[model samples]
Target: MSVDVSKIVRSHEGKRGKLISLLQDIQSRYNYLPREALEVVAEQTGIPLVDIYGVATFYRSFSLTPRGSHLVSVCLGTACHVRGGREVAEELERQLQIKPGQTTTDNEFTLETVNCLGACALGPIVVLDGRYFSKVSPARVKQIIKSARAGKEEHTADGHVFPVKVSCPRCNHSLMDFSHQIDGHSSVRMTMAFGGKHGWLRLSSLYGSFNLESEYDIPLDTVVNLFCPHCHAELISANVCPLCGAPMVPMLVIGGGMVQICARRGCKEHRLDLNGVNV
Candidate 1:
C-alpha cells in the first residue's frame, strides 16, 4: 500500500537520533514498515538505507512487514523459559496455526516470540497487544486466543529484566557461562563486563580480537595481526597472544566488560581476559 512517508519525514526533520520515533510513527500509520517509506526516509534524511534498515530490524517493536490488528508477543526469556515457556510457545503455534514471526491468514494477530520480557515470577507468559498473561499453561492457549478475539483482556503482569546472551562472531555460539576458569586476579570491572547490561557471547572454540572502537586515541592493529574470520575486519587488541606473540582480538564481554582472544587460524582456542574499559 502507498504511504505518505513525506509527511512522516517532515514531522521528523533533522532525523539524527530520532530514527526510532520516525519508524514508530510510520509503523503506527501503516501498522508496519513498508520498504517504500524506508527508502523515502533515507532519501529525505540523508541516512544510508542500510543504517535505516538496521535500526528498524534491531528493535523488537518495529516490523518490516505488514502486521495484524493485534500483536502477540511471547516471552521465552530465561526465567520464563525454565517455567514451561517453550511449551506455551509450542501450544500457541499449534492453536494459532501460525509460527513465530508470522501473521494469521485473517489478519487478526501477529505472533512473535522474544528472548525476555522481565517478569520472571510470571513464567510461561503470553502477551496480547501489550497486556501480559502470567503462569500460562499449554491447555490455556485456546482460552487466551478466544479472549483476545472477544476483545477482552486477560491477566497481566509487570515485566522484569534478565542477563544478556553473548555469542561468537564467527559461529554465533553463546558465551554467557564461561565454564573454564583462569586463576589470575580478577578486578571488579572485569567481573561486571562478563555479565553486565550489554551483550553476551560464547567463544568456546573461537578467538576474539580487539574491538578497536574506542573513545580515546586507541592505536591500530599492526601489519602482523590477523583479521576476524567472519568479517575480515581488522582485529583490535589491548593484550598480546601468550603463545603466538600476536595481538589478541578485543570484544565486548558485556557492558563494562571486555574479552581478548587470538584470532589466528590454529589459535582459535585462545581466550584471555584483558583490561576493562570504563563505562
Candidate 2:
C-alpha cells in the first residue's frame, strides 16, 4: 500500500507537538522520512522548508536517509559514557566504515548515538533494530556488532546482547564506562555546534579508516539535551536518586544524533545495565 505522507501532517491540525509525532509516524511507515515526504509536510503545515528540515535534523533519533533492514543505535548517554559510550560510537563507525549520519554500503545497518537515554543505571545502552540493550561495554561491543551483522536474535545471560566493540586507538583507552549528566540547568544542546561536540569534521579525510585509531579524537559537545530524568524536586545528581534510591529514566529523547528513535513501545524506556552502573 502507498504511504500517505500528507496525512501525517494533516492529522496534526497545525499543532506544535504533532511535528514530532508526525515525523515519528512518517519514519515508522517509510523506515526513513523521504525528503519528498518532508516537503509535503512543510506544504501541508504551512511551515517553511528550512524550518521543517531544521525540525527533522534537530532530533537525534530522526533519520534523513533510508535505514537498513537491521538498524543499530549505540547509546553515548551519561551512564553509558562512564561505561565506554565513545568507544562504542567509534568502533561502530569503524566496523561500518561510515560516519554516524551515513549508512553502510551494503545497506545492512545504520549507526547513531544519543547523549542520554535515561537508562543511566543501564549506561552504555545499545538499541538494535529498535530493541533495547542495556549496560553495554567495550569488550561487549565486538560481539554485538558480530551478532548484529550476522542477524542473531538473542543474547547471552552474562549481560551480552548484540556484539559491538569499544577499543580506542589512542593510549589503549578501551572505554569501559560512560555518564549522561546535564550539570547545568538549561536543556542540553545535543546538536552540532560550531565549536561543539556535533559539528562537522574531516574524520575520514584527515585520518583514513585504516588509521582512525591513530588519529586525534574529534571534539564534540552535545547541543540539544532536553529530557529530564525525573520530575521531582531533587531531580539533579541522579541515575538513581541519592536520597530515595529510585530510578529516573527517559520517557523519550527527541533528538541528538543521526536518527530520531524513541524508547521501545512496550517498555517506554530503553534497556539499561543495572550491574554496570552499580560498579
Per-residue lDDT, model 2, residue 172, is 19
Q: On a 0 to 100 scale, what is the lDDT of residue 191 in model 2?
A: 14
- Expressed as tens digits, the lDDT of each residue in 1-279 for candidate 2 is 124876556555634245655665677677777888988887777778898789777554566788876666676666677788888777777777877656788888766655554446656777676466666666776787788778685564232222221211111122212222112111121111222333211111110011111112433221122222222111111123233333322222222322221111121122221101111
Number of clashes in every candidate structure? 16, 53
lDDT of 1 by residue, 41-126 (tens): 88888889999999777554557787877777677778888889889988888888888878899999788776654346767767
Off by over 4 Å in 2: 1-3, 14-17, 77-79, 157-279
Residue-level error in angstroms, candidate 1, position 21:
1.7
RMSD of 1: 15.9
Best by lDDT: 1
lDDT of 1 at 271: 37
Estimated TM-score for each candidate: 0.54, 0.51
